[model samples]
Target chain A: MINIKKLALLIVFIWPSVLLAETMEVTLLYVGPTDSQAWAGSQQGLDEANLQGQFLGQNYQIKSVTMKELQDLPASNMTAILVDASKKNVLSLAQDAKYSQVPIFNLTSTDDALRSACVPNLFNILPSDQMDKDAIAQWQAKNPDIAVKAQAWHEDFVKFAASQLNKRFKRNHNVNMTDDAWAGWASVKMISDTVARTESIKSTSLLEHLKNDLSFDGQKGDTATFRETGQLRQIVLLVNDKNEIVAEAPLRGVKNGLDSLGKTTCQ
Target chain B: MKFKSLLLSTLIMASTAAMAEPSHRVFISNEKSDSVSVIDMKTNAVIKTINVGERPRGIGLSPDGDKLYIAVSEENAIAVVDLKTLQLEKKLDAGDDPETFDVAPNGYIYLSNEDDAQASVIDPKSGKVIETIPVGIEPEGVAVSPDGSLVLVTSESTNMVHVIDTAKHKVVKNILVAARPRGLAFNSDGSLAYSTSEVGNEVTVIDTKSLSIIKKASIDLKNSKPMDIKVSPDGKTLYVTTGRGNSVAVLDADTLEMKANVPVGKRVWGLGMSKDGSTLYTADGVSSTVSVVDTKTNKAIKTIEVGQFPWGVAVDD
Candidate 1:
């Protein structure tokens, strides 16, 4: 009848002081080295959340963990894990986080695997490659001249930019296609801004806000956010030989010519 | 009783005379509101609202106090405001995503373009881009040395501090720092420069002459996400705003230690120190308020509500 061992374990792990501490400890898992620009930028965002008291009464702590670290981490103790879209290790990290029931925020380049995998807690800030393609198409519908130019230039630039990006994409099965990769930077900025606005350092709330209300004002001028299903409302831009910009054809949500560009691409 | 009353009246009259001196004007850029709110020094009231570009951020006044420059991130340009008329005089193309800037003593303006990953040097008189010095990734913050010989730029993406020679307009060296370095400020002596790393939640102290990070002081706040950094004129204290924390973290400049965290409005994006260096003004983006802090007491003296999403801030004496 006496359960002294269980009581001692509970006291050590669930003490009120540890639970009600002023600072919330959060560990962010990144797929790449912490020094990389993209990961470094994300780390900065986490630091900003801590500085601003977003995790009030909860000290915000971040540890840049790689794929190897994912295996070693006690998942139940981690607040959230952020995976880079371009990283080859993303799939493993996502799978591990899913098994452990740890929430994952993906800054991925595609949505096929995420949607197909159907992880309830997995969310992405960046739109998929298809969304980028569709965004350009919607934009083309609005500016026919720009669309024509983009179509003409696509043949020239696609070969070079695609080849450069394909090396990494091929290694990550989750990535099926490549749009304007420059959108990656915009996505990072958008997510950081959203995190700053929501002021929710908690992993759960941050994930929810990113999925529901965070609208990405991409470099290509698309104002769209991610859906619960992990699809994004995005505008795609096709780059030409001269590195000039354009929108593609066969728009999704065009009602009239004037409102063509304003159409949302989220599924 | 009559003599005592006369003395009291005389004392009150003297105090009123001293208070009658003109108060300095603090200018705030409301990014979401797309306007700059000018606050009167004495009354702490918004004196005027001037419209700028799409998203007004990184505001600064010329040394002469005759002109004000606002970096419009959305528009990818800078709006020059004539202090006399309080009207936008001209819009200058400043590469891409012009966020922060520093005005040199020689009337040249050095601005960091976040998108272009470069710093554009502008001749204020002509409003022309003299030279664009390519540095590290996402150059967000810039500061010029007191002697105007060297310019320092903080690259958020690359996590490096680029030191540039003013004469040649070229990056001489790159000093690595903590993550997401956004804010840059130089000490009065120009011997040292302070940079705020948003991701690192720390302030990096750099030896200007050596261009090396001497030490890093961790700011003790949850997100201590320091954005805009301003050194007092006396050079005794450093003021940093936690963009997400909605508060200002003060540090002793000499000791390089965190002194206090004074609460401000939501999302304090930009900060400005008064000409006298006694008062600090911060633009609260979300709460739409400018929290005025008395430097000596290190407390929020007044909160002047302004346009929606106030961003950059400047002071005119």
Candidate 2:
């Protein structure tokens, strides 16, 4: 004695909800506490992309996982992963056989060694240490008067950068920008830019676009493109705690197209 | 000795008076110094630095060559400099954040306000705003046609060129271009306009009549960031300043072909041509100098050091 009218209404209400809930999952691997400043920036970028509906005809389901959670998951389904882990974890995860086919955006690490590691699937969103060093060198060459010495302690600079981010971060959670935070924000933006260009949800298509035809507007008033070494070539700005631009690297004086600041040729 | 002094005085007076139309003075706006550098063509020297105000950019002269209008960006006003006296005559209240402007043939000045996202049409004589036409975001470059019927404003963020009807002060058409279109130039006939895309590393030519992009040509130099563009008086050649490449790219205007890439000073941004159109002057911001390029030989003849960060240049002709 099935009630036909009641069953039909239940089917009509439940089926669209199931279809609507279907979304493209973007996994974020957090090595440390999610509340940290570095992870906060990346989260902000993901939220922005979701609000903007950057992906074509699809909704983004952001799934943030801890290192333990990531390791426990079945690795075969990994499509795209954003790595907000320590340099060591980033290196190990990149080489891990489980996520070999997955495209990973390295958000927190700037170690030059990561670039030399020929992981075809890994892309560095932030400028590498060598790239930043070269930029400083170029700036020093142009402006010999500015004594740009490499110091071990610049906690104040990080605080200032974080404050700058805090002003822009509109959500209920506010965090200062650390190296990881800046990298996270930049990495999400780089992916969003590539996705916007490709207009495809398939991971292979996105990876192809990132490797071959990706030029991201890093929101630094300039466009940054990937080098052969998987490093992002961009204009690095040196600023003080007051958020004033002290100097910009790849300064106007660096001759022969070196002002773009990175590896010129692609690998 | 007395006769020699008398002859010297006579020579000076005669030279000053004879320097009438097609004058050999090049004026450059220095952003950091808040002044204008006046270069003497004969001596190839900066003879004067006139204090204008904060962030003076986009220098252009009236058709009569008696007045020079400078976009003082910080003050949100246009400073009119009297060329004869070499002094600031008055300030006209333009829109907010005026980055660049051009003088129409009908004597009206079209200015692009970067933050305001609109262009102010100001009558230079009366110092009154004719109208403010809303345009795209972050308008950086402004160009008026030779016939003065229309003006083009390039918005960097929007990546579109707003073709404005000068008579009605309305946007006639919106032609999309490459990323970060900074500066533009028009041919002698007002039939074609060439715009430089800073990030795209390309130049787009717009057919004025059709309001369509005729063609786009990529800059061949490695890591080229083409910023400012200028066409020759005869419209035979196009000169584009590659910002990061530190060179001026020469192109065939008609064929849209790359002819030469002349190396100049570091970080060349603005360009000015001599009155005779035989020399090209580059306002090199990073080098703090202006490189003079001989058009015939396509070589840098001289580099005259100027104020800090010279942003724009104009010739008195």
Predicted model with the maximum TM-score: 2
Model 1 stretches with alpha carbons more than 4 Å out: A1-267, B1-23
Q: For candidate 2, lDDT tens digit of each residue in B89-153?
A: 99999878788999987789999987666889999878888799877656789999989999999
Per-residue lDDT of candidate 1, residues A125-202 (tens digit): 454544455556666556666532222112223321222223322333233233322333333444444444554445
Can you list each candidate's DockQ? 0.02, 0.07
Per-model TM-score versus the true fold? 0.55, 0.67
- What's chain A's TM-score in each predicted model? 0.54, 0.75
Docking quality level of the chain pair in candidate 2: incorrect
Q: What lDDT score is found at residue B227 in candidate 2?
A: 87
User: After aligning candidate 2 to the native by TM-score, how far in Å is the CA of A135 from where it should be?
Assistant: 8.1
Q: Cα miss at A218, model 1 (Å)?
A: 16
Stretch of 10 with least lDDT, candidate 1 chain B: B15-24
